[model samples]
Target: MSNQPPLAAADLQKTQQGNQVARTPEQTLVGFMNQPAMKSQLAAALPRHMTADRMIRIVTTEIRKTPALAQCDQSSFIGAVVQCSQLGLEPGGALGHAYLLPFGNGRAKSGQSNVQLIIGYRGMIDLARRSGQIVSLSARVVRAGDEFSFEYGLEENLIHRPGENEDAEITHVYAVARLKDGGTQFEVMTTGQVNKVKAQSKASGNGPWVTHWEEMAKKTVIRRLFKYLPVSIEMQKAVVLDEKAESDIDQDNASVLSAEYSVLDNAPGE
Candidate 1:
């Protein structure tokens, strides 16, 4: 509909090149993670033993190993990594300290997924020990063939004997925490109770609940036991985060990592 004549080929080529130069490069998960803002947040939150660069490398490797992580909402993924760093726990490795799991955001029209931070049973114990009140903390799964018994009131006691059947069905899981003051506290849950907890969880069908059922069961009992232990504030917060992850609650976006940092919707220059 324009009356003006078409531009010459040279002018058209120059315009196209200029547009190309003006366009920003597509941001990859690694690049988004490496942004100065993200790096600064990580450096400020990480413990003395951990460096932002090292944490970034760990997250980058995790993304590579689980491509689904790359597809997760970048802000949530970064926030989860920052939370792990703040707690001094390594994610997605053989250490089993913590994990970053991608979960579909059912509320999003685009079906964008978010990353949920899962603190492992080992991670829970690690945090609890930092309080200096606990001398030893451990969790174990009792199989059908194992001889296990316990008491609750005065003269409380527990006894367990190993059975040869390594593949025997799990009958119960328990966690015990011995305090520095020569006191011991423990919690035990039957398989039925553990199953009820799992059924209530939104992630019951996936994540550690699937691949590491025994570990998760042990963690569940440990969480119940923590109610009586003198754990640190960080450990308390970690438990809350773990519960939110299991329940698939969306209210954690603003408070998951820390009150100081807000999860950005997009990387800079996007």
Candidate 2:
């Protein structure tokens, strides 16, 4: 062992303070979490894509990538379209359509888009595991929890329509999340409506899409049962289409673009 001189009183105090801060990171988090206002804010800022984190850095990074339609619709528009693909919405083909809408539209309104998404089974399982709920998806549901869905609906006057030069008042969007039925399952739905779609071009046009607003609602039922579900190996195909694709909502449109996703080893739950 090497001989060492004793620390001065001032030095000892400084070292103790540094260790206390380093070791209490969890405490720091909990201190904020314990605040009712903080809890409410967390509840309000729920993620649209399953279990993504609520941290600003993580959330904004995902949003910057052509955000999922849901997240982009709910969060900052400019933030969502950051270098995202350009071929998915209209002018953008699969190469462009990373998100539901164009990234960095150059004309972002306060709130113009709203997208809905479903959480993946694997993500939910991971969350349950982290919560110490050891149960299979096929087994009797061991985790009964509530979740709040979040999306930025078009409210106020926004949306430059397709052809019209004038913009429209977007009004406010109403969204809510709830546990389905009297069971451990859950779902989110739109309660208030979006109104006032405006045209984009100076010439008269079809304006913005106004129909299909209620198409997202799900009839609620009490969930008396559920099981632990495994991560689906079937993979997911983008059922969406761009203006270049044939058929509007249907008809198989062969994607001319490649698909990708972030490495999700430590991703969060729904």
**What's the TM-score of every candidate structure?**
0.81, 0.22
Against the true structure, candidate 2 reaches a TM-score of 0.22
lDDT of 2 at 100: 29
Off by over 4 Å in 1: 1-27, 106-111, 251-270
* Residue 152 lDDT in candidate 1: 88
RMSD of 1: 12.4
Tens digits of lDDT, candidate 1, 1-270: 111221222332343353434432123567656767557777777777778898988888777777887766555566677678777788874767888887876443335687788878877766665666677777888998888999989999999997999999989998877777899888999999999989977678888889988888888998888767666657767777788777757525424322221111111221
Query: Which has the greatest lDDT?
Result: 1
**After TM-score superposition, what is the CA distance of residue 248 in candidate 2 from its true location, in Å?**
16
Go through the candidates in order and give the clash count of each: 0, 31
